[model samples]
Target: MNIFAAIADPVRRSLLEQLAREGPTRVVDLTRGRGISRPAVSRHLRVLGDAGLVRAIDHGRERHFELVTDALAEVSNWTATLTAKSASAPQPPVAGHHLDALGLEVRRTVRERGTQPGTRHTAASSTATGEIA
Candidate 1:
Protein backbone atom coordinates (compact mmCIF):
# COMPACT_ATOMS: atom_id res chain seq x y z
CA MET A 1 0.00 0.00 0.00
CA ASN A 2 1.15 3.54 -0.78
CA ILE A 3 2.16 5.61 2.23
CA PHE A 4 -0.12 8.45 1.14
CA ALA A 5 -3.01 6.08 0.62
CA ALA A 6 -2.48 4.54 4.05
CA ILE A 7 -2.63 7.98 5.67
CA ALA A 8 -5.55 9.09 3.47
CA ASP A 9 -8.06 7.73 5.99
CA PRO A 10 -8.94 9.93 8.96
CA VAL A 11 -8.85 6.99 11.36
CA ARG A 12 -5.39 5.91 10.25
CA ARG A 13 -4.09 9.49 10.38
CA SER A 14 -5.58 9.86 13.88
CA LEU A 15 -3.93 6.61 14.91
CA LEU A 16 -0.59 7.82 13.59
CA GLU A 17 -0.98 11.12 15.45
CA GLN A 18 -1.67 9.21 18.64
CA LEU A 19 1.32 6.94 18.19
CA ALA A 20 3.56 9.95 17.52
CA ARG A 21 2.25 11.89 20.50
CA GLU A 22 2.16 9.03 22.98
CA GLY A 23 4.93 6.77 21.64
CA PRO A 24 4.53 3.01 21.30
CA THR A 25 1.07 1.88 22.40
CA ARG A 26 -0.97 -1.30 22.24
CA VAL A 27 -4.16 -1.76 20.20
CA VAL A 28 -6.33 -1.57 23.34
CA ASP A 29 -4.77 1.74 24.38
CA LEU A 30 -4.98 3.11 20.82
CA THR A 31 -8.66 2.23 20.69
CA ARG A 32 -9.46 4.45 23.66
CA GLY A 33 -11.73 7.45 22.74
CA ARG A 34 -11.48 6.45 19.03
CA GLY A 35 -15.04 4.94 19.05
CA ILE A 36 -13.69 2.10 16.92
CA SER A 37 -13.41 -1.56 17.85
CA ARG A 38 -10.06 -3.14 18.65
CA PRO A 39 -10.28 -5.20 15.45
CA ALA A 40 -10.77 -2.08 13.32
CA VAL A 41 -7.81 -0.39 14.99
CA SER A 42 -5.74 -3.48 14.33
CA ARG A 43 -6.72 -3.39 10.67
CA HIS A 44 -5.69 0.23 10.39
CA LEU A 45 -2.43 -0.52 12.13
CA ARG A 46 -1.83 -3.41 9.72
CA VAL A 47 -2.21 -1.04 6.78
CA LEU A 48 0.14 1.43 8.43
CA GLY A 49 2.68 -1.31 8.97
CA ASP A 50 2.34 -2.44 5.38
CA ALA A 51 2.94 1.11 4.21
CA GLY A 52 6.10 1.27 6.42
CA LEU A 53 4.64 4.24 8.29
CA VAL A 54 4.53 2.28 11.55
CA ARG A 55 6.11 -0.77 13.09
CA ALA A 56 4.82 -3.25 15.65
CA ILE A 57 7.07 -4.41 18.44
CA ASP A 58 6.46 -7.54 20.46
CA HIS A 59 6.70 -6.61 24.13
CA GLY A 60 5.91 -9.13 26.83
CA ARG A 61 2.27 -10.18 26.07
CA GLU A 62 1.31 -7.27 23.78
CA ARG A 63 2.26 -5.76 20.44
CA HIS A 64 3.18 -2.08 20.65
CA PHE A 65 2.84 0.15 17.58
CA GLU A 66 5.09 3.15 16.99
CA LEU A 67 5.61 5.65 14.17
CA VAL A 68 8.45 4.83 11.75
CA THR A 69 9.62 8.29 10.80
CA ASP A 70 12.20 7.08 8.25
CA ALA A 71 9.42 6.14 5.85
CA LEU A 72 7.83 9.56 6.36
CA ALA A 73 11.17 11.06 5.25
CA GLU A 74 10.36 9.92 1.72
CA VAL A 75 7.21 12.02 1.77
CA SER A 76 9.06 14.96 3.30
CA ASN A 77 11.81 14.79 0.67
CA TRP A 78 9.28 14.68 -2.18
CA THR A 79 7.42 17.71 -0.82
CA ALA A 80 10.69 19.58 -0.32
CA THR A 81 11.68 18.90 -3.95
CA LEU A 82 8.33 20.22 -5.18
CA THR A 83 8.64 23.36 -3.05
CA ALA A 84 12.21 23.96 -4.23
CA LYS A 85 11.25 23.60 -7.89
CA SER A 86 8.34 26.02 -7.53
CA ALA A 87 10.52 28.51 -5.68
CA SER A 88 13.23 28.47 -8.36
CA ALA A 89 10.93 28.55 -11.39
CA PRO A 90 10.34 31.89 -13.11
CA GLN A 91 6.91 33.40 -12.57
CA PRO A 92 4.87 35.00 -15.34
CA PRO A 93 4.61 38.80 -15.36
CA VAL A 94 1.64 40.20 -13.46
CA ALA A 95 -1.50 40.42 -15.58
CA GLY A 96 -3.76 43.41 -16.53
CA HIS A 97 -3.07 46.83 -18.13
CA HIS A 98 -2.39 47.70 -21.78
CA LEU A 99 1.29 48.38 -21.13
CA ASP A 100 1.74 44.85 -19.85
CA ALA A 101 -0.05 43.49 -22.90
CA LEU A 102 2.04 45.68 -25.16
CA GLY A 103 5.23 44.55 -23.44
CA LEU A 104 4.19 40.88 -23.95
CA GLU A 105 3.35 41.53 -27.57
CA VAL A 106 6.72 43.24 -28.12
CA ARG A 107 8.58 40.29 -26.59
CA ARG A 108 6.53 37.81 -28.58
CA THR A 109 7.26 39.60 -31.84
CA VAL A 110 10.97 39.82 -31.08
CA ARG A 111 11.16 36.10 -30.28
CA GLU A 112 9.02 35.00 -33.20
CA ARG A 113 10.87 37.25 -35.65
CA GLY A 114 13.85 34.87 -35.61
CA THR A 115 11.71 31.76 -36.22
CA GLN A 116 9.24 33.16 -38.75
CA PRO A 117 10.14 32.65 -42.44
CA GLY A 118 10.95 35.67 -44.66
CA THR A 119 11.35 37.89 -41.57
CA ARG A 120 14.27 40.09 -42.60
CA HIS A 121 16.57 41.31 -39.85
CA THR A 122 18.85 44.32 -40.23
CA ALA A 123 21.39 46.02 -37.93
CA ALA A 124 18.77 48.60 -36.84
CA SER A 125 16.18 45.88 -36.08
CA SER A 126 18.60 43.88 -33.90
CA THR A 127 19.62 46.92 -31.84
CA ALA A 128 17.66 47.44 -28.60
CA THR A 129 15.71 50.69 -28.47
CA GLY A 130 12.94 52.07 -26.20
CA GLU A 131 10.55 52.10 -29.18
CA ILE A 132 8.63 48.87 -30.03
CA ALA A 133 8.24 47.78 -33.70
Candidate 2:
Protein backbone atom coordinates (compact mmCIF):
# COMPACT_ATOMS: atom_id res chain seq x y z
CA MET A 1 0.00 0.00 0.00
CA ASN A 2 1.07 3.59 -0.59
CA ILE A 3 2.35 5.67 2.32
CA PHE A 4 -0.81 7.82 2.27
CA ALA A 5 -3.09 4.82 2.38
CA ALA A 6 -1.08 3.14 5.10
CA ILE A 7 -1.32 6.24 7.26
CA ALA A 8 -5.00 6.93 6.49
CA ASP A 9 -6.13 4.78 9.37
CA PRO A 10 -6.70 6.78 12.58
CA VAL A 11 -4.77 4.25 14.64
CA ARG A 12 -1.70 4.49 12.43
CA ARG A 13 -1.91 8.27 12.40
CA SER A 14 -2.12 8.36 16.19
CA LEU A 15 0.89 6.08 16.46
CA LEU A 16 2.89 8.38 14.23
CA GLU A 17 1.80 11.44 16.21
CA GLN A 18 2.83 9.78 19.48
CA LEU A 19 6.21 8.89 18.08
CA ALA A 20 6.65 12.47 16.95
CA ARG A 21 5.86 13.84 20.40
CA GLU A 22 7.53 11.28 22.69
CA GLY A 23 10.46 10.21 20.55
CA PRO A 24 11.39 6.52 20.42
CA THR A 25 9.24 4.15 22.46
CA ARG A 26 8.60 0.44 22.76
CA VAL A 27 5.38 -1.00 21.32
CA VAL A 28 3.98 -1.43 24.83
CA ASP A 29 4.51 2.21 25.70
CA LEU A 30 3.12 3.32 22.39
CA THR A 31 -0.07 1.39 22.93
CA ARG A 32 -0.83 2.69 26.39
CA GLY A 33 -3.32 5.42 25.38
CA ARG A 34 -4.74 3.38 22.53
CA GLY A 35 -7.83 1.29 23.12
CA ILE A 36 -6.55 -1.50 20.89
CA SER A 37 -4.56 -4.47 22.11
CA ARG A 38 -0.77 -4.49 22.02
CA PRO A 39 -0.78 -6.95 19.11
CA ALA A 40 -3.05 -4.70 17.06
CA VAL A 41 -0.86 -1.72 17.77
CA SER A 42 2.16 -3.79 16.77
CA ARG A 43 0.45 -4.57 13.47
CA HIS A 44 -0.12 -0.85 12.85
CA LEU A 45 3.51 -0.20 13.64
CA ARG A 46 4.53 -2.87 11.15
CA VAL A 47 2.52 -1.19 8.40
CA LEU A 48 4.06 2.18 9.29
CA GLY A 49 7.53 0.63 9.30
CA ASP A 50 6.92 -0.83 5.85
CA ALA A 51 5.77 2.54 4.55
CA GLY A 52 9.00 4.20 5.78
CA LEU A 53 6.95 6.33 8.15
CA VAL A 54 8.48 4.76 11.25
CA ARG A 55 11.78 3.10 12.07
CA ALA A 56 12.45 0.47 14.69
CA ILE A 57 15.64 -0.06 16.63
CA ASP A 58 16.61 -2.94 18.87
CA HIS A 59 16.76 -1.85 22.49
CA GLY A 60 17.86 -4.85 24.50
CA ARG A 61 14.97 -7.34 24.18
CA GLU A 62 12.44 -4.83 22.83
CA ARG A 63 12.12 -2.79 19.63
CA HIS A 64 11.71 0.98 19.95
CA PHE A 65 9.83 2.80 17.19
CA GLU A 66 10.35 6.41 16.13
CA LEU A 67 8.95 8.56 13.36
CA VAL A 68 11.08 8.88 10.25
CA THR A 69 10.96 12.67 9.77
CA ASP A 70 12.82 12.46 6.49
CA ALA A 71 10.10 10.34 4.94
CA LEU A 72 7.43 12.87 6.02
CA ALA A 73 9.53 15.66 4.58
CA GLU A 74 9.55 13.90 1.25
CA VAL A 75 5.79 13.71 1.31
CA SER A 76 5.54 17.38 2.26
CA ASN A 77 7.79 18.47 -0.58
CA TRP A 78 5.82 16.44 -3.08
CA THR A 79 2.53 18.00 -1.99
CA ALA A 80 4.02 21.50 -1.94
CA THR A 81 5.26 21.15 -5.50
CA LEU A 82 1.90 19.83 -6.65
CA THR A 83 0.07 22.73 -4.96
CA ALA A 84 2.43 25.31 -6.40
CA LYS A 85 1.90 23.99 -9.89
CA SER A 86 -1.86 24.07 -9.53
CA ALA A 87 -1.86 27.56 -8.02
CA SER A 88 0.42 28.96 -10.72
CA ALA A 89 -1.61 27.69 -13.62
CA PRO A 90 -3.48 30.36 -15.58
CA GLN A 91 -7.15 29.99 -14.83
CA PRO A 92 -10.10 31.00 -17.01
CA PRO A 93 -10.57 34.72 -17.42
CA VAL A 94 -13.34 34.89 -14.81
CA ALA A 95 -11.27 33.33 -12.06
CA GLY A 96 -8.08 35.19 -12.98
CA HIS A 97 -9.96 38.48 -13.12
CA HIS A 98 -11.51 37.83 -9.74
CA LEU A 99 -8.13 37.21 -8.15
CA ASP A 100 -6.69 40.31 -9.81
CA ALA A 101 -9.54 42.42 -8.53
CA LEU A 102 -9.10 40.99 -5.03
CA GLY A 103 -5.41 41.85 -5.11
CA LEU A 104 -6.12 45.42 -6.18
CA GLU A 105 -8.73 45.83 -3.43
CA VAL A 106 -6.31 44.63 -0.77
CA ARG A 107 -3.61 47.03 -1.98
CA ARG A 108 -6.07 49.93 -2.05
CA THR A 109 -7.25 49.19 1.48
CA VAL A 110 -3.69 49.06 2.81
CA ARG A 111 -2.80 52.34 1.11
CA GLU A 112 -5.86 54.07 2.48
CA ARG A 113 -5.22 52.82 6.04
CA GLY A 114 -1.52 53.66 6.11
CA THR A 115 -0.06 56.13 8.70
CA GLN A 116 -1.17 59.68 7.92
CA PRO A 117 1.18 62.63 7.86
CA GLY A 118 1.71 64.42 11.25
CA THR A 119 0.35 61.36 13.07
CA ARG A 120 3.76 60.07 14.16
CA HIS A 121 4.83 60.62 17.78
CA THR A 122 8.53 61.07 18.51
CA ALA A 123 10.09 61.02 21.97
CA ALA A 124 12.76 63.65 21.09
CA SER A 125 10.10 66.08 19.77
CA SER A 126 8.02 65.64 22.91
CA THR A 127 11.03 66.57 25.08
CA ALA A 128 12.18 69.55 22.92
CA THR A 129 11.11 72.89 24.45
CA GLY A 130 10.72 74.63 21.04
CA GLU A 131 8.96 71.68 19.33
CA ILE A 132 5.18 71.88 18.68
CA ALA A 133 3.07 69.54 20.80
Q: Highest TM-score, which number?
A: 1
* lDDT of candidate 1 at residue 90, scale 0 to 100: 88
Tally clashing residue pairs in candidate 2.
0
Pairs that clash in candidate 2: none
TM-score for candidate 1, please give it. 0.67
Give per-residue lDDT, candidate 1, residue 76: 94
- The numbered model that scores best in lDDT is 1
> Per-residue lDDT for 7 in model 2?
78
Q: How accurate is candidate 1 locally (lDDT)?
A: 0.88
Residue 69 alpha-carbon offset, candidate 1, angstroms: 0.6
All models, RMSD in angstroms: 8.6, 14.5
TM-score for each predicted model, relative to the true structure: 0.67, 0.63
Which stretches in model 1 have alpha-carbon errors above 4 Å?
93-133
TM-score of 2: 0.63
Give per-residue CA lDDT, model 2, range 73-127, as digits (tens): 7679889999999999987867877899988887776577463444554666555
How does each model score on lDDT? Answer: 0.88, 0.85
